[model samples]
Target: AQSVTQLDSQVPVFEEAPVELRCNYSSSVSVYLFWYVQYPNQGLQLLLKYLSGSTLVKGINGFEAEFNKSQTSFHLRKPSVHISDTAEYFCAVSDQYGGATNKLIFGTGTLLAVQP
Candidate 1:
């Protein structure tokens, strides 16, 4: 089974400040990792994903993440954040060999609170 763990329940940061949301996963088989953000009254949006290839993957809104195999971490980082960045972030993992279902197991989620 694959599972994700988000270390922080909430992350507070000021405008234009850098932030990192920690995410770690535990899986017995190969898996695909992803970061999704949900804004107020909106659906979940894909921030980034790591299917294969390079370890460093960049996503929209100036966000990026590094896939660390040894540590089993795919932490999301932003050099600078804005007030609009405030939202609920989620870390999810899907079993690579799960076939067509491609069901995703998500973490508890991390709330990013940006203060002006």
Candidate 2:
């Protein structure tokens, strides 16, 4: 079975600060990568994904990540952050055959605490 591990449980920063959330995975086959964000009392939104192209991938809200094959990692980062960016960020992975429903296997969770 494949699994995902998020290195941090919470990250606190001032408004307009920068942030990075580390992610790692273990899988025997090729996989798809994703970063999803969840606001308070809401469902998750797709932040970004790495299907099968370049290692560096950009997504909505000025966020980006790099897929490292040798290290089996996908870390999310943002140059600057906003208070609105405060939310739970999840790193996920799915098998290459992943379809709509089989799209993700998420990390435990990481709460981005953006202080104003």
- The lDDT per prediction is 0.97, 0.94
Candidate 2, which ten residues in sequence have the lowest lDDT sum? 97-106
**Runs in model 2 with CA error above 4 Å?**
98-103
TM-score of each: 0.98, 0.94
CA deviation > 4 Å runs, candidate 1: none
lDDT of 2 by residue, 1-116 (tens): 67999989999998888889999999999999999999999999999999988999999999999999999999999999998999999999999866568857889999999999
Model 2 lDDT vs. the true structure?
0.94
Candidate 1's TM-score: 0.98
Which residue pairs show collisions in model 1?
none
